[model samples]
Target: MTNEQKALITATVPVLKENGVLLTKHFYNRMFTHNPELKNMFNMGNQQSGRQQTALAMAVLAYAENIANPSVLIPVVDRIGQKHVSLDIRPEHYIIVGKHLIASIQEVLGDAATPEIVAAWTVAYNQLAGLMAGHETNLYEQQTHKTNGWTGWRPFKVGKKTPESAEITSFYLYPADGGKVAPHQPGQFISIRLFLPQLNLKQARQYSVSSTPGHEYYRISVKREKGANLDTNGMISNQLHDFINENDVVDLTAPAGNFTLAPDIDAPVTLISGGVGITPLLSMLNSLVENDYTHPITWLHGCRDQSVHAFRNQLNDIVKTKDNVKQHVFYNQVTDENREAGVLEGYLDISKVPSLNLQPNAHYFICGPSAFIQKQYHDLVGAGVNKQHIYFEEFGPQLLSLN
Candidate 1:
C-alpha cells in the first residue's frame, strides 16, 4: 500500500476504535433503511442484543490491524465466509454493505473525512470486499459441487433421538432425499440452520458429528443448555431439545471444521474432552476403531455426572471390544448408585495428562465450552505439547476476555 494509504488507515484506526459502535449503528441503520430487504439477512435479535454491533466493530478493527499484511487475515475471512454461506449471504449484499459503510464513515467523520481519507477507505473496503466476494464464491461453489454432497441446506431427517442422559440427547440424522452422503473426517462439524417461527428469522449453529464417517447417517450429541443459575439458556440448543423430534427435517450444511484427527496412525493419540465436548472426540475414536488404526488411543472425558455423560454404552462397548482403546471417565458430583466405581471424580487436571503414557509425537484434540477449552489449551501448552499437534473446537466465540 502507498504511504498515503497507510497514513489514512492509521488515522482511521483511532477514529474507529473511538466511535466504532456509532459507525456500526449508523451503517446498519442506513443500510437497512435504504434496503429494507437486508433486514432479513441479519440477525435482528443479535443486533438488538449488541452482538452484531460487537461483531462489526471487531471485523473492522481486525481489518485495520491486518491492513499492511492482508494474508494474515485469510483464516478470519474464511470463517466469515462460512458464516455468510450458512446465512445465504451473497456478493451483491457485500456491495450494499460497502456503500453503507463508506457513507457512514463520511457522515460520522464530517470535515475529517478528506478526499485522501475517502480514497483510502474506498480502496481498503474494495480490497476487503473483493476478498470476501471471492472467498464466498469459492465456498458457494464448493457447497454446490455435486461430487461434494455439500450443496446448500440438505434435508436430514431425525432418524433417532436417544436420550443418553438427563441433560444430553444423541440425534441420528439421515438424508431425507436418500442421496449418498459425503464421508467426513473425524472431528469435523456440520452447520445446522433452523427457522425460528417465533422470531421469523433464521439461526445457525455448528455441531460436531458424534458418529464415525462411514455411517449412512450423521449423529450429533447435544447437551441441553439450561441456564446456569441466572444465566440465559442457549437459544439454539434449547430449541433443538424442546421442539425437535423424530422424523423432523433439519437443514444441514456439509461438515466443515479445522480440527481433525491426523491421518497418520503411527503416533499415539490422546483425546481429552469435557462435557459435551466429547462429541467430536467420539467421532475420532469411532473412526479409529472402525478403520482398525492400530495406534494406541487414550480417551479421557470429564462430565458433571454419569447422568449427563453421553454415549456411555457405546464408549464402553468400544473399550471392551478394542484392545487398543483405553477409557478414563472423570465424573463431578456423581450421585447415582448404579454408577461405576473407581472412576476419577473431579475436573480434569492438566498434570494428569502427561502421565497417560503418550509418546512425544502423539496428537491431542480438545473441545468444550470456551473456558474449559482455553484452560486445556493453556495446560497442554504448559505440558510441552507441540502447538501444531494440539487442536480444539470451541462451542462459542473465543473472544479475548476483557476482565
Candidate 2:
C-alpha cells in the first residue's frame, strides 16, 4: 500500500478501538446471511457469546496498527493459521470474508467511509488475506505430507465413550475408513464438527487430543458445559454428551495447534491445570511417561472436588508407580476424606508448594480458564521463571496476553 493508504489505516485506529466489535458483528451477520452454508465451519457457540466478534475486532485493530510492519504479528498469524487449518479454511473462503468485511466497514461507517478509505481498507484486507492464505497453504501441505495425514475433513466414528467424571466424558475416535490415523503432536487438538438439530446447522469445536500420540485412535475428553438457564454456551458440548453415541460418525479435521511439547527436551517439566483444562496437559504428561522421561515431572491440578476430577485413577497409578513424578491436588470444595487423601483446599498456588521443582531451566505448561491462565502466568513470571519457558493453552477465544 502507498504511504497515504497506510496512514489512512492508522487513522482508523481510534474508530476501531471505539466500535471495532460493532464492525465485526456487522460483518459476521452480513456474511452469514449471504453465505449461510459457511456456518458449518464456524463455532456458533463463540458467535453467540460474542467472543468471535471481539477477537476479530482486536485482530483487525492490531493489523491496522502494524500496517507498516505487519510481519511483527507473525506469531499471532501462525496461531490463527493453525486454527484455520483445523477448520479446513481455504483461500476462496477468505475472498468471501474480505468482501463482507469491507462492506460491513462501509455500512457501519456510513458516509464517513469515503472511496479512498474503503479502497485503503480493501488493499489492507487483501494483503492480510494473502499472508494468511500463504501460511495456511504451507500448514495444509505439512499435514498432507505427514504419514497417514490428509487435508480437509475426514469421517471418524466414536469407538468408545467412557465417563471420566460426572461432567467429563472421554470419546475414543477411530477413522471410519479403518485406515491408520496421523500421529498428532502431544498437546495438539482436532476439530470435531457435528450437526445441531435445534439450530439446523452444523457446528465445529476444537477439542484437545487427550491420549498420547502414535495411537490408532484419538481421544478427546469433553466437559458438558451446563451454562446458565437458557444459555447457548454449552449447546455443542451438551449435545455431544447427551446425543452422540458409540459408532456414530462425526467429521474431524486433521490435528493442528502450535502449543505442543518438545519430545526431546531434557529438563524438568511442570504441568498445571484447573477444572476441565487438564485434557491437553494430560496428553503431554502421558507422552512424557511413554517416552520414559527421566527428568523430574510435577503434576498440579485444581478442581471442585474428586468427583469432578477426571482421570483420577489413571493419574493415581502414575503417581504411585512413577518415582520421578509427583502430584498435588487442590479442591475448591474439600471434605474430610479429601483431607485424608492429601488434597489441598482452595485454588492452585505454586508458591504454596515448594515441590513443583521450579528450576530456572524447567519448562511450565498451563491450561485452564482465562482467569486461571492469567493468574498462573503472572505468578510464574513473578516467581522468576523465564517468560519464554512458560506456555499456556486457553479454551475459547485467544484473548489472553502472556506478555
Candidate 3:
C-alpha cells in the first residue's frame, strides 16, 4: 500500500483494538446470513464460546499494530496456516472472508468509517490474506506430496472405539479403500470432518493422534465435552462419542501441526499433562518408550482422580518397566486407595513436587487447559528451563502467549 494508505491503517489501530470483537462478531453473522453454505467450514462450538470472535479480533488488532512490519506476524501466520491446511481452507475462502470483514468494518463504524479508511483496509486485508493464503498453499503442497498423504479429505472407517476413561474414548481409524496412511509426527493432529445431523451441517475438529506411528491404523482419543456451551460441549465430540460407531465413515485431512517432540533424545525430557490433554503426549510418551528415549524421562500427570485418569494401567506399566521413566500422579480428589498406591492429593504443583527439581538440558512439553498450560510454562521457565525448550498445546484457539 502507498504511504497514505499505510498511515490510514495505522490510524485505525485504536479502532481495531476497541471494536475488533464487535466487528468480527458482526462479520461472522453477516457472512453466515449472506452465505449460509460457509457455515460448514467453521467451528460453531468456538463461535458459541466466543473464542473464534476473540481470536479473530486479536489477530486483526495485531495485524493493524504491525502494519509497517508485516514480517513480524510471520510466525503467527505460519501457526495459523498449518491449521488452515488441516481444515482444507482454500485460497478462495479468503475472498469471502475479506469481503465480509471490510463490509463489517464500514457497517460497525458508520459515518466515522470514511471511504478512504475503508479503501486502506481493503489493501491491508488483501496483504494479510495474501500472506496467509500463500503459507497455507505451501502447507497443502507439503501434505499432498508426502508419501501416502492426500489433500482435502479422504474417507476413513472407524475400526474400533475403546473407552479410555469416563470422559475419553479412543477411535481407531483405517482407510476405507485399504490404502496406506501417512505417518504423522508424535504430537501432530489431523482434522476430522463429520456431518452433524442435528444441525444439518458439517463440522471439522482437530484431534491429536494418540497412538504411536507406524501402525496400520491412526488412533485419536476424544474427550466427550459436556456443559452448556455448545461451542465447547459442541456437536463434533458428542457425535464421535454417541453416534459414530465401528465401521462408520468419516473424512480426514492429512496430519498437520507444529507441536511435536524436539529431536534431542539426550535432553532430559519432561512430559506433563492434565485431563484429556494427555492425548498427544500419549503418542510422544509411547514413542519415547519404544525408542528407549536416551534421557531421564519424567512423566507427571494431574487429574480429578483415578476414575478419570485414562490409560492408568498402561502408564503404570511404562513406569514399572522403563528405568528412565519416573512419575508423579496428582489427584484433586484422592481416596485412601490412591494414597496406598503413592498418588498425591490435590492439583498439580510444580514448586511443591520434589520431582520438579531442575535438570540439566531439560525440555518440557505441556498440554492442558490454557490456564494450566500457562502455569506449567511459567513454572518451568522459573525453574531455569530455557524458554526455547518449552512446548505446549492448548485445546481451543491458541490465544495464550508462551513468552
lDDT for each candidate structure: 0.78, 0.92, 0.88
Instruction: Give each model a TM-score.
Output: 0.86, 0.97, 0.96
- Residue range 25-131, candidate 1, lDDT tens digits: 88888998999776655766556666677778888987886788888888778767766776667778888898999998899889999988988988999999999
On lDDT, the candidate that comes out on top is 2
Superposed model 1: Cα runs more than 4 Å off: 16-52, 107-111, 146-148, 228-233, 264-266, 335-340, 358-360, 398-403
Model 2 score (lDDT): 0.92
Candidate 3 stretches with Cα past 4 Å from truth are 264-266
Candidate 3 residue pairs in backbone clash: 45-231
Over the stretch 272-332, how does candidate 2's per-residue lDDT look in tens digits?
Answer: 9999899999999999999899989999999999999999999999999999999999999
Put the candidates in lDDT order, highest first: 2, 3, 1
How well does candidate 1 score on lDDT at residue 199? 59
- Overall local distance difference test of candidate 1: 0.78
* Best of the candidates, TM-score: 2
**True-structure RMSD, every candidate:** 3.5, 1.3, 1.5
Off by over 4 Å in 2: 228-233
Q: Which 10-residue window of candidate 1 scores lowest in summed lDDT?
A: 394-403
